[model samples]
Target: MFRRQFLGLGAAVLAFGLSLCGTAGADPLPDLKGRTIVAVTENAYFPLNFTDPKTGEGIGWEYDAMNEIARRLDAKVEWKTSSWDAMIQAVQAGQFDIGMDGISITDERKKQVDFSDPYMVSEQFMLVRANENRFTDAKSFAADPKLFVGAQAGTTNYFVSVSDLLGGDDKSPRLRLFETFGASVQALKVGDVDTVLMDKAGAEGNIAASPDRFKIIGNGLGHDEFGFILKKGSDLLAPVDAALAAMKADGTLKALDKKWFYDYRAAH
Candidate 1:
């Protein structure tokens, strides 16, 4: 029920500005001549790219955004799924034309793949079982000897848990690693771990889905900018960026954000 406000223009003002930029009728987008682009994702990150339980089909913000981009660019997309750990490297090896997993844009990651302009900015938040009251924030959670966090290794969540909450000791016993965010969340649900660090948007979605089972505690921990990954030197980079810019300018991106982050309900 608690939605975090962003540090930018409000939705109505942004939409009005976008409409002015696009004029009334003329299409200014580039045509890709029906080239097929391969897109991959983990499909586990809630409200970004994940399987819909009711439909057994992929759906989320990224899916909608990418599809619209392809439409505007006069291209087609072939979607694929990848494990979270292998996504960047796989894209770097030219296995996929692009990858999306709410991946943060960081200097360390830039070495492997080129990133598009950020689609969304987010922050880390603590997710814990609703009945727990042992600690209200990270500091108190760290002070307790019996508390530990569940996270997927090689993720922003894991790194934040290590650096911000566990004294930068990645090998600390207080950190339990899982193969997927779903696994870590399962661990949290069963009391296997005291908490899980998640992006604020995701935490909000999960909490809204299961209010009695989960709750977010403490202030947001860190800022992150999410972008789509492209192989270095890929020809598709510029076109994808252009399409994204158009989407932003036309308010399509803003509409997708509202649909996924604030309006849609996932079947838990």
Candidate 2:
């Protein structure tokens, strides 16, 4: 299974190099002039897509990448917002031309909507209080029935906690479900839950945003790749995929990763 394969890989095997540049003389993409693409996101996933607290504007890695993709494809982007729970279905129903919110590409989802080439891959980690000492890793935390974990219902983080970290009981009383990822983190902040499972990117973003309040614990639980989502059989898929390939070949993707993941971490 994909989940088992991802979890079994060591950290070294999961690590990626951002320094890799794209190859020279890659094939050019088809011109998409005069096309306008509508994109949707939750704007709640940090580092991927989030509203800037100070500026009150949507900004982050996905926003940057999507803007670049639009520029390269000669298309204008019209941004819209939706709740994470509704995003995939909304896209599948043709309510949006494209959707992105750190969405993981799974075979199940592929049946409803097509995914662009993967834009980012990340690992899951345990986010705990800064002074936490009761448990250091998943196994230790699972052994202690008193310890609670917060995760948004239906998210990969939630399933990971249920199956991979805990004992595969979906109805575990120790699991506290939230409506949003940020809400789960907030639950952890107030000591409502002992920890939360978050992707390494979001964990870093939250830790950077509140270094004195939270910290990541344990090795990464598993790895997952994120991709842009579109309605199945949408005409935009080929051009979007080509744009992503060009960005990968031209080092734009690596540059954005460094800017949002590394440089942003340092500045924040």
What do the candidate models score in CA lDDT, each in turn? 0.85, 0.82
**RMSD versus native structure for model 2:** 7.4
lDDT of 2 by residue, 151-212 (tens): 88878898889986678998899999989888999999999999998888788778887879
Which ranges of candidate 2 are over 4 A from the true structure? 1-24
Which pairs clash in the backbone of model 2? 22-249
Q: How many backbone clashes does candidate 2 have?
A: 1
Error of 2 at 140 (Å): 0.4
lDDT of 1 at 91: 99
How many collisions between residues are there in candidate 1?
0
